[model samples]
Target: EAAVTQSPRNKVAVTGGKVTLSCNQTNNHNNMYWYRQDTGHGLRLIHYSYGAGSTEKGDIPDGYKASRPSQENFSLILELATPSQTSVYFCASGDLGGPNQDTQYFGPGTRLLVL
Candidate 1:
């Protein structure tokens, strides 16, 4: 089974503060992604990595960045956070997927609030 877990399920931060969201997967998947979900916008990808030691920007990578130091872990970094960045973030993973990539499994979610 594909399992993804995210840390600090909820967070509160101040403007200009730094926040880090962590994700860990036991599926040992080759592909992992970080996305933010907001009203009307659906889930938009922030970053993704194919495997360890690699990372790539996604549609909404402006205020966020990602790191994949190993096959089982990925982290999202928010630098100088802003209220605009406040939203529910999700982490997902897939194993050698193609057309069925839609089967990616998501973590519960991380609600981030910037005060």
Candidate 2:
């Protein structure tokens, strides 16, 4: 079974401060992604990594950074937190889409509130 875990299930950050969200997956999937979910915008991909030691910018990479140290670990770094950045963050891992990619399994998610 694919398992994704995130640290600090909840977070409260001050504006201009830094918030780092960490994720780990034991699925051994090739592609891992970070996404944020809000009321209107829904889920937006922030960053993704194809494999260890490699990262890629996703749909919205501004104000956010990602690191993949190994196939089992991925981290999302928020350099400067803002109220607008408050949302639920999720980490997912799956095979690179085609016919092989089943479905991206997501973590429980981290709810971040920036004040």
User: Model 1 — TM-score against the truth?
Assistant: 0.93
Q: What is the TM-score of each candidate against the true structure?
A: 0.93, 0.93
Q: Please give the lDDT score at residue 2 for candidate 2.
A: 37
lDDT (10s digit) by residue, model 1, range 1-115: 4378999899999999999999999976898999999999999999999999999999989988899999999999998999999999999998676666647878888999999
lDDT of 2 by residue, 71-108 (tens): 99999999999999999999999886677676798999
Per-candidate RMSD, Å:
1.9, 1.8
What candidate 2 gets wrong by more than 4 Å, as runs, is: 97-102
Model 1, residue 19: what's the lDDT? 98
Q: Where does model 1 exceed 4 Å of error? A: 97-102
